[model samples]
Target chain A: MAGYGTARQDHLRRLRRIEGQTRGLQRMVDDDKYCIDILTQVSAVTSALQSFALSLLEEHLAHCVAEATRNGGPEAQEKIKEASDAIGRLVRS
Target chain B: MAGYGTARQDHLRRLRRIEGQTRGLQRMVDDDKYCIDILTQVSAVTSALQSFALSLLEEHLAHCVAEATRNGGPEAQEKIKEASDAIGRLVRS
Candidate 1:
């Protein structure tokens, strides 16, 4: 977690921007925008969320997973499993 | 795109809620929340987006892809390819 401390603000800012994008998408739909336009917005939102997820995953790997592996115990195994599960879900999504 | 017309409003509402969640996540980080707690929120956001993507993909497959397959032309081929590419990216993400 401490490892992520430095990048925390950056991630927060990115998420906030994404939040605005999501709201804009909602407004587009509410306004009865063109079909392709709406779909394009959906694609953009999906890509933004995917990028965020990838960054978070990278942080988790470099910090939590690395620490757990270094510790070398049940906690390490649990952490690895948790990360694997997350990756599995992401890929499936 | 017309196929999605019926469910458009539903999707918009869902996206709006996700936007709120994203803003909340930003607030959590800004307030210096606990690491694990923030991570849990991240996981929730990821899951929400994943579900949205899955639903959109399903709609594309059932309506867009099915229509394209029925048409049986170059446009059909293009649509099929587009859907396949989208699915590929979603899975990779």
Candidate 2:
């Protein structure tokens, strides 16, 4: 079970939308869309993905991290470190 | 014809890969993958899309923007403005 269990359905919905956006991007490229227009579409897709990630991260923190820290063990520290690393990756990516 | 004419095939290839990545993400979420693992994959997909956008933008700068600027007319300024706005959207996204 993942921290995002409660939000799994929502996550799936978001992913499906993103997948559609990716297909839209392919169509834009294939149809010889203007450079600026394609870039705008890409930006929209990227933003959608970012929002999905943020929502997932929030769920993870609220569930997994919260549970670990509540237990007050070595796993708590490990979870914090892991979450920080994930956040770093998201920011730098 | 757009600025990325020479790179259109490459862009299609990249978008196809991104589409695959997005589907993989859906699988990960569906499989009850660990939260951190899923987030890491999301970061990877986001990075891949960023690289795609940057490459397309570079091609636009070199092809369309360069051609417009070389013409040294009102449209030249217009193209520069349009490109700058696209860049701004990419950055904010």
Candidate 3:
């Protein structure tokens, strides 16, 4: 679907950018940047990354998961289990 | 790397389960399940999905981003930028 494609593209772009920020944070450490400054950036990066994940999760639930559940069956049950385990990991982290 | 592989495998398993949860939610809707109950499950599913994304992002930062930044250069900078944008999107969502 066009909508899915657009969303995916956007998601990919954002992910790539996050990947870059992560690298920047590492560089800060290596360059011996001020501890406070590094920590601040690190915090921002963490929050930013967390926010992105939240968005994707929201979308997945609203669309993919919702649609699949509507159809109902073995596949649907599998998806629910998959989601539960995934969530468990996230919360644990 | 073996570590990455193990982590990836774990992540994949979680994702698949979440996928199943979403489907279950859909079935509930079709079955005309109670609104409150459905909403409860939906909320749980949302939380679970978010957790999965967070873990992946954390890993990316700890392993991929950190390593790339240590090596330093255009590639590292690029990765940092990618991460930033991704975080921005996540927060926005």
Local accuracy by lDDT, each model: 0.72, 0.90, 0.54
Candidate 2 clashing pairs, residues 3+ apart or interchain? none
Best by TM-score: 2
Q: Quick one: ranking by DockQ, best first?
A: 2, 1, 3
Which parts of model 1 are misplaced by more than 4 Å? A1-5, A27-93
Docking class of 3: incorrect
Best by lDDT: 2
**Could you give the DockQ of candidate 3?**
0.04
On DockQ, who's better, 1 or 3? 1
| Cand 3, B chain, TM | 0.82
User: Cα lDDT for residue A80, model 3?
Assistant: 75
Q: What is each candidate's DockQ, to 2 decimals? A: 0.34, 0.86, 0.04
True contacts kept of each: 0.34, 0.86, 0.00
Candidate 2 lDDT tens digits, B53-81: 99999989998889989998999999999
